[model samples]
Target: MGRVAGKVALVTGAGLGLGRASSLLLASEGARLVVSDIDEGLATHTAAEIVRGGGEALALRHDVSKPEDWSAAMAAIEQRFGRLDVLVNNAGIAIARNIEDTSLAEWRRTMAINLDGVFLGCQEGIKLMKKSGGGSIINLSSIDGVIGEADLAAYCASKGGVRTLTKAVAVHCAEQRYGIRCNSIHPGYIWTPQTENYLRDLGTLEQEKAKALSRHPIGFLGEPNDIAYMVLYLASDESKFVTGSEMVVDGGYLAV
Candidate 1:
């Protein structure tokens, strides 16, 4: 049997990149998937892909920054699956800018999507998880969260917020005996659309890639599946004893 058999998992930003990879992996492991994205077409396509692969999935356009959107999403989950076993807060954006270059709007936008979204997810997740007798929450934080960077000021702040918020939520769930687990995943230099855009303007594609590759001692950039593998473990019963942890899957980027 699959590791997450019979579990119901909701993955935000499931339309693409790490989010899509995590959704696909979880569904393959037997979790009924709730594939959500801000883009309706993307979410629908992801859900269809899962079904074609012999997995059960539902598609919903969700904006994690909005509480109303979250409520509606929870309603859909309750109506379709009756319980929520896992929530992956994988929706986020990174603005490539220094403090001097960042505007108020950019900072607020970053916080809304990165920080506020996770806060809303945790709030709603805990409520539904309480009703379901427990669940797991995986927040997609970056290696930037643990370290400060001059260029990614807003991204850094927002991700750092997620790191702390995850811990606080984990502690609360444990104290309440809610049986829920909350944790953050810190990844470094994963090859995703966002990162592609981040490096595209810096220089030639090959030059930017070489610079990125040199950052990791592992000698290569990581694929989405690397992070997905970690998500699968955390989403499964194998991580029941794990909570309030910052699980790093950075390909040794932070080691040096």
Candidate 2:
């Protein structure tokens, strides 16, 4: 139960879905949490839930795409918990569009949130994590990042950026002997609010969901906790030797 006990973890996009699940699980495992989301109310709600579950948590409104927001969030973390040991750069958005249909503005916006956000988080997180003698950085990529989707061009591009960026960060930290480990998580069609919205937009949620299910050789979609457990493992000292790796929790989706 105390897998991450005594650690300070910050999860961006902690308001809902995988972020919410990860926050709850990490808190239950005894990590003090900094729950940050663009939506202040959602972040507060998640934080309150953590506290109710007998965990320590602080909620803050943070826009991950903004450098100033990153500075403010780091400052707040320093003021509250003093150091951050685990960082989950989980804030992202999905735009369902083909390459030809995706406008430049749409591409820019996707990159800003999904790619740029993680970049900023890693950059800022490294500074504070170094102060605390090292930590783990978990960046959420997707199976689409490893493969391709005709309708998710921008999302694929952004997540692909995250996948590579994680490796780069891991290598740099290792070379500098900062004791920080960085890794990317590639998840399949997890049944989250994000996926729900994406499928709904594609018309006939049930049919789209079935199509998604058929793509996974495991025969079903994933739940939030499916990914949360992976987050827990990476956050714990058990993965001390693991770094710069791609952890795929895609229910055998890539196999087919």
Give the number of the best model, judged by TM-score. Answer: 2
**lDDT per prediction?**
0.94, 0.97
Off-target runs (Cα >4 Å) in candidate 1 are none
lDDT score at residue 140, model 2, on the 0-100 scale: 98
Which lDDT tens digits does candidate 1 get at residues 1-256? 4999999999999999999999999999999999999999999999999999999999999999999999999999999989999999999999888899999999999999999999999999888989999999999999999998777899999999999999999999999999999999999999999889888856587898898899899989999999999999999999999999999998898999
Question: Per-residue alpha-carbon lDDT of model 2 for 189-208, expressed as tens digits?
Answer: 99999999999988899999
Between which residue pairs do clashes occur in model 1? none
What residue runs in model 2 are displaced by over 4 Å at the alpha carbon? none
The TM-score between candidate 1 and the true structure equals: 0.98
Best by lDDT: 2
